[model samples]
Target: MADNSSGGESTFTVLLALGANAAIGVLKLVAGLLTGSAAMLAEAAHSAADTTTEGLLLAALRRSGKRADRQHPFGYGKERFFWALIAAVSIFVSGGAFAIIEGIRTVLGEEAEQTLAWVAYAVLGVSFLLEGTSWLQAVRQVRKESAAEDLGFFAWLRRTDDPTVVTVCCEDSAALIGLLLAFAGVGLHQLTGSGIWDGIASLLIGVLLTFVAYVLGRINKGLLIGRQADVRLVRSIRQRLDGHEGISGVVDLLTMMVGTDQVLLCARLDFDDALGAADVERLCVRLENELREEFSDLDEIFLEPVPREDPDIRARVLERYGENPLSTRSAPGGATRSETPSGE
Candidate 1:
């Protein structure tokens, strides 16, 4: 559910990575076969894994965009998160595991003659250029998104609901580092006439891939478990609700990121007591329309009218916030109207 421009950027980035990794994978495989360098072979597997990851990301973008249906009233936004999780697993199994096993085999087996050391060096040079190109594109997209959100780069990354860009960026970064490790292994093996250095480089590449996989896996796991929406978005919504005229107080506000740019929100509000039921219904309809106009990401909303001083409600809010709940007033029946400044 990312906006049109954002969704287009994500697709373009994935395609660029897919093309780069596909070409690099072929080149690395040829070089590895000719030189018998475990590190080079590991790099080849790494490229293959990256290529697969890009494909899966493409599917994620496509499927997650599906329109809402009977069974899935909330739509298919979380499909992106599910596929991203699978892509992380692919990195570990196809790339990391293969590299570790190959490293062990080469280290324990007989020495391999470095016939095409020059070929590996040439491939590495070209691969670096390709990978660098892909990496720059990902970085540019990340920076643009961060700026739009008025947040720092790393902060945006942590809070971003989109997974395709993150997946591509991380994969490309690991690819670049793996290339360097392969270069070192190939260079050292040729210089010393020992495959041990080559095996060591392969092991390092495995560890690098494993770490990337773990980081990505943890992120997607949190998303699948339903993380809260962006802090800024939540705070803005709360502030808007507080300033509304008829709304005496906001009892509870809940938000969840259902998809890349889609949010599900529920707000329990205390309206003016003198208002009639018909007036309250009209206000509810108007408020929903106004909120949707202001916040395009709000995909679904539920508004409940409740007394602000309800004991059970107060108790539940206290348990969640532990004294600093996101309400206009500090306590029940405290401030008649909100005096706290915006962004509190």
Candidate 2:
């Protein structure tokens, strides 16, 4: 057992991003209307979509924090993932799809006056600064999560379970890049006296949004279905178990995310040869306490004591349960001695 809890860092981050996007959306809408800039209009629509998705993400964080009940023993952690997936889908349909269609329409239309193109550029400059601010916040969180480890940003993004964290990061990065494209498109159109360059910028923004939406959807879907913690976290847990005096070593350790900030840990431990049943019980309690203190994200823990080097019994257990018996797939009758705690 461990202290089951979640955090508010994700909510705070989403709130900041939402405010930025809301302001950006308003600015783009006004600029697009005044100048008839295709890129500006597409960016406005994209900002609108982002605002809606962030609202959904905030709702998810709220729902997933609910306490567990009889019918749902695992609590509502998956709700966060469900909303996250919806957010990704919305990004594709509302932002990416809409942008592509707008780009095509603009590409085929007649040239507009370059008189107000300057307004679009001004809006883009401001939007880029705001988006960059949001992105910096996301990157800071990632670095803190990795314990100051200098892993690549993409690698960390794939490994993290916090949907809001990655969503905000990806969205902000896309927005900054989009602002650049818009600027280039407007600049080229102003210099060349053609609308083709502006349309091309809209096209590029749409393609970029589509790709980012795809990545977010795939990652969130995995979390929604139940994904294990990263390999690095698992190895770290193993090290902790190995260092404990009463335990010989960890035979196997497995983990799965039940919520954005909650994880369930299950492990088979090999007790020291001289420890008795009472000693084993006390050791289990002590180790669990240690783990809870060390890993605030852990919500639950199941420790199964067994001999680390017992080949005969290990083979039999493996044959019956396949992998990770804690997942509810077990031998006939749905209960077995090997599945029992401490080889009882």
Candidate 3:
């Protein structure tokens, strides 16, 4: 199961980003028209794309939470990754591509006077405020989750392996940066009467968005393709299995990430011969129970036992029979071979 609190918090943050960006996108579109600033237009496109992505992300989160079925034994966790990839693509196509085109047009001497530079400034300020709020919320969630995992915020973000949160955070941060760039461009164009500065800013914002999209895409791809879990976690599980009673040794272990925090474990244990079949069964059960108790994220556990006495079973039985061979006592009548043994 996922961490409900964290998931909910992340979902809330995404919704906030969506709401904020939707409003900001409208304002930016108006400002872009009023000022004819390429940078403002690019910012508007970026926010619009972000809004769409957030909506998709929320849908993905819901779909990914569906229970496993016969057709999908591993559940629908990858749905989140799939939607995150879609979000990245949205950013690239809607935001990056638009920005690039607008920038190229502005660079090609398409000069439009900033009829409403003040309007752009006002919209950019509002955009900054909204994006900042969303970004702060995302950062807070990351900090809280990372602290729980004993990792720094950025480290946790990188290591989390959850595409939704990572993508959302990246988008929010990029939006914030885009807002700053848009403001700078508009300000420079107003100050120097040079639309080229605005064009350059648009180009830079496009580059930033594209880079962010690529990063998000890579992360989601890894999750979709089933990346391996942390080695430390696997080692910890192996140590626990090795230390269990009735387990002679841990021969092998395997772990796989089934979801954000869920894992499947397979372990091979060597058991002493003196341990009975019933004992082996009980040990396996207990070990699985303990593992579940210790690691709530461990979803399934398979334990195989190697018996210690299979090689000497017959020899040991024969030796025991020889040592206690029937008590030979002298019978009242002269001992016959059949009567030689009193007990058998």
Give per-model CA RMSD: 2.6, 6.8, 14.2
Which residue pairs show collisions in model 3? none
User: Model 1 compared with the native: what TM-score?
Assistant: 0.94
Q: After superposition, how far is residue 141 of candidate 2 from its true place, in Å?
A: 3.2
Clashes of each: 0, 0, 0
* Per-residue lDDT over 99-119 for candidate 3, one digit per residue giving the tens place of the 0 to 100 score: 988998897876777777888
Stretches of model 3 off by over 4 angstroms after superposition: 273-278, 305-344
| Candidate of highest TM-score | 1
Candidate 2 local lDDT, 1-344, one digit each (tens): 11222146667778889999999999999998888778888899889888988999999888988999998888898898899899999998999988888899889887776658878888888988887787788777766665444556667677777788889889988988898888988889889988888888889889999998999999888987778776666667777886889876566666888986688898888888799999999989998999989887788899999775577756755664455446332333454333322221
Write down the lDDT of every candidate, Cα atoms only.
Answer: 0.89, 0.80, 0.78
Can you give the TM-score per candidate against the true fold?
0.94, 0.79, 0.84
Pairs with steric clashes in candidate 2: none
Best by lDDT: 1
| Candidate 2 lDDT trough over 10 residues, lowest sum | 335-344
Give per-residue lDDT, candidate 3, residue 7: 73
Prediction 2 global C-alpha lDDT? 0.80
Best-to-worst order by lDDT is 1, 2, 3
